[model samples]
Target: MLSKFVAAAALAGAVVTAPAAAFDKPQTTYKVFQFPQDRIPRIDGEFSDWDMVPESYVVGQDQMTDQDGGHHNPDKTLNIRVKVGWVKGLNRLYFLYEAKDDYWDFSLPGLHNDTFEVVVDADLTGGPLIDVQHQDIWKPEWVGQRASKTDPRVPGSLTHWYSHGVQAQNYHIMTPHKDKDWAMAWGSPTWIKNFPFANAAQSYKFTPGQSGTYRLEFYITPFDHADPEGPERSVESKLREDALIALGWIVIDYDDVKTDAKNGFWSLSTQRPMFGLASDLPLFKLMPIENAKLEARWSWKVVDMDRRLVAFHDDSVGKATGWHWDFGDGTSSTEQHPIHAFAKPGSFVTILDVTGPDGTSRRSKVWDVQLR
Candidate 1:
C-alpha cells in the first residue's frame, strides 16, 4: 500500500507546478521531518527524543547568514542547530533548538533579551505579517494620523486589531526566558503562545551574561487565520503529509548587556525582514515518515449520519496489492476505498485485511462507526 501511495504521490507531484518564490534563495527548500505518531517528540528539554531524526534534517548555523553583519564569523562566537518536525494527525510544528554561544544574555525583562524568532506562513498566504506593514495603514493619508490614539489606523486601533498576524505569524522566543513568557506572538493574537496552543521547555547551565550551551524543545500551532479576538474565530492551518509551507527563523544574539548593541541577527532566510514579511520566508515541505513499517490501518467518516452512510479510506502502509473490508453487516467489499450504508443502527465489528508483498495485516474496529 505504501509503495502504491508513493507512486501515485510521485505522479501527482510531477504534474504540480512549484509555487512562485518571493524571497532570496528561490531554489532552496527545507524539509520538515515527519515523526511517526507513536514516536512523537515530547516537549522536554532533552535531546534524546530527537535521536530518531536523521542528521540530514538538521539546519545548522552554516545555513544561516548574519543579517545584521555584526558577527562576520558565526562559528567563532555563536552556533546553533535547529530541527523541525510534525506528527501525522497533529497541526502543531515541533522544534528542537540546540545552541552554544560564547556569551548568553537574557537578563532583560523585555525584547532586549537573546531570542530565537520564528515566522510561519503555513498556508503560503504570503504578504506582510506585522501590523506596521499592513497595506491600508501604510497609505500616504494614514501616515501621520497613526500617532493619534483615536485614529482607527493606529497600532491599537481597529485596523491593527484585525490586520496584524491575521494571515501569518511571528514568534519572538526568548532563548532562556526569565520572569516572562516563553515567547511573544508578534501581533494582536497573543493567545497563540499560551497552553493548548503552544508549550516549551528549556535546559541550560549558564547564568545571564555567562557562556554556555542551551537546549530548547517546543511546539506551536500554525494558524491560517489567528484572530486577535481569540481562537473562536480563528482557523488552524491544516497540516498534511507532503504539504509545503513557508517558514523561517532568526537568532537574535545579544552578547553585551551594558550596551544596547546586539551581537548578530542570524537568519535562515536570506532576507532580514522575514520576521515581519511572510513573503520573505523560505519554503518547508512536510515530509513523510522515513522507513515506516507496513501496517493495516483505516479511517471512516459518516458521509450522511441520517442515512447511515459512511466513507472508508485505506490508510495502510507498505505495498498493498489487495484489500478486503468486512462491514460487519454481512456485506463485504474488495475496493481499496468504499462507501457503505448500514441497514440498521447498532454496534458492529468492522475488519479490514490488507495483503502486500510483506504479507497480510488486519485491523479491526469495534463499534467505532455506529449511528443511532
Candidate 2:
C-alpha cells in the first residue's frame, strides 16, 4: 500500500530506530563505506541533454569532479563525486551528510538575501556533488537564480544550512516571494525537517535490495517550485509540502550509473525529510515556500450583459499586432477589444484566438450567446 509522503519524518535516515522487519532483517542492518575508485563510467540527467565523467578527486577528500565543464558557470561547476562501498548482505541504506555553509541569498528581491544549491550527478565511477553559493542576480534582467555576491558560499565560508538562517531553511520555503502564505504543509511528507539538502559524497540507503541488474535511477526535487494541480493527488494528500516536493524527484538514467561491486554495489543519492521540532515519524510539513505567486486573477465582472455590438467594418485582420472587432451588431462598438459580436445571435461560441510574441497561439471561448 502506498503511504503518505510524510513517512519521511519517521524514517528519515538514522533519525530513528529501524522498524521491526524493515528489510526482512532485524535492526542490525548492513553498512556502506567509501573505497578507492576502480574506474569511471558515464553520467546523465532526465532534465538535460548532457553527459559527464569523473575527472579527479578534491585533494585529501573522497570528492571527485564529474563534469565536461558545462553546468553552472565553469567556475561554479565545482562539483565533487562520491560512491558507496560494496555491501554483501544488503541490509538497508541511509545518508546524513555534513552541511558546511551558512550564507543566505534570497532568490527574489526584498526578501531573504542568501542562496546555495545542492546538485548531484552520478557516473559509472561514482556520483559528484556541487554546493553553489551565489549573488548578483537582481542586477541582471533574466528570470532565473541570481545570487549577487561575488562570493556565493557564505562569502568565503562554507556554512551549514542551520547557520545564519533558521534550522532546515531550505525546505520550508523560507522567503517573502510573491505568494508564500499558503505553505501549511510539505509537498511530500518524506522531506527532511530543518535541512533537506545534503553535502558532496554524502551517504544514503536503499531497501528491499534492487533485484539483480537493473538501472539505478537518480532524481532531484528543486527547492521552491510547486504544482498545485500536480498529477499525484494521493501522494500529495499525505505528507507536508516539503516531503511532497522531495518525492517529486528528478532522476538520471540507469545506463549512466555504474556500481563498483557485483550485486548491490550501485551508488544511490536520496533526500530525507524530518521534523525540526520533534524526532517523530510521519513528520508533517506545516510551512511555506512563500515565493510562488498566484497567477490568473478570479472574479471578473460583466458590465453590460444586454449590450449592443454596433460594428460597421472588419476585414482579413491584417497580420495585425492584435485582433480588432466589428461584431456586425449594435451591442458594442466603443469597446475596442478582441471580443466581437453579432446582432442576430441565438447561440454562438465566440472563439477569440490570439498569438503571443513567441509565435505560440492561444484562444478564449465564450458560450451561449443570445442577441435576444
Q: Highest lDDT among the candidates is held by which one? A: 1
lDDT of each: 0.81, 0.22
The local distance difference test score of model 2 is 0.22
After superposition, the stretches of candidate 1 with alpha carbons farther than 4 Å from their true spots are 1-24, 69-76, 133-156, 305-308, 341-347
User: Candidate 2, which segments miss by more than 4 Å at Cα?
Assistant: 1-320, 325-348, 353-372
Model 1 steric clash pairs: 1-318, 1-319, 1-320, 2-318
lDDT of 1 by residue, 4-28 (tens): 4432443343222236455446898
Residue 194, model 1: Cα distance from true site in angstroms: 1.4
> Local error of candidate 2 at 309, Å?
13
When summed lDDT is taken over every stretch of 10 residues in candidate 2, the lowest stretch is 120-129
lDDT of 2 by residue, 84-179 (tens): 221112211112111111111223332231111222101000111112222321111111223343433443332221121111112322211122
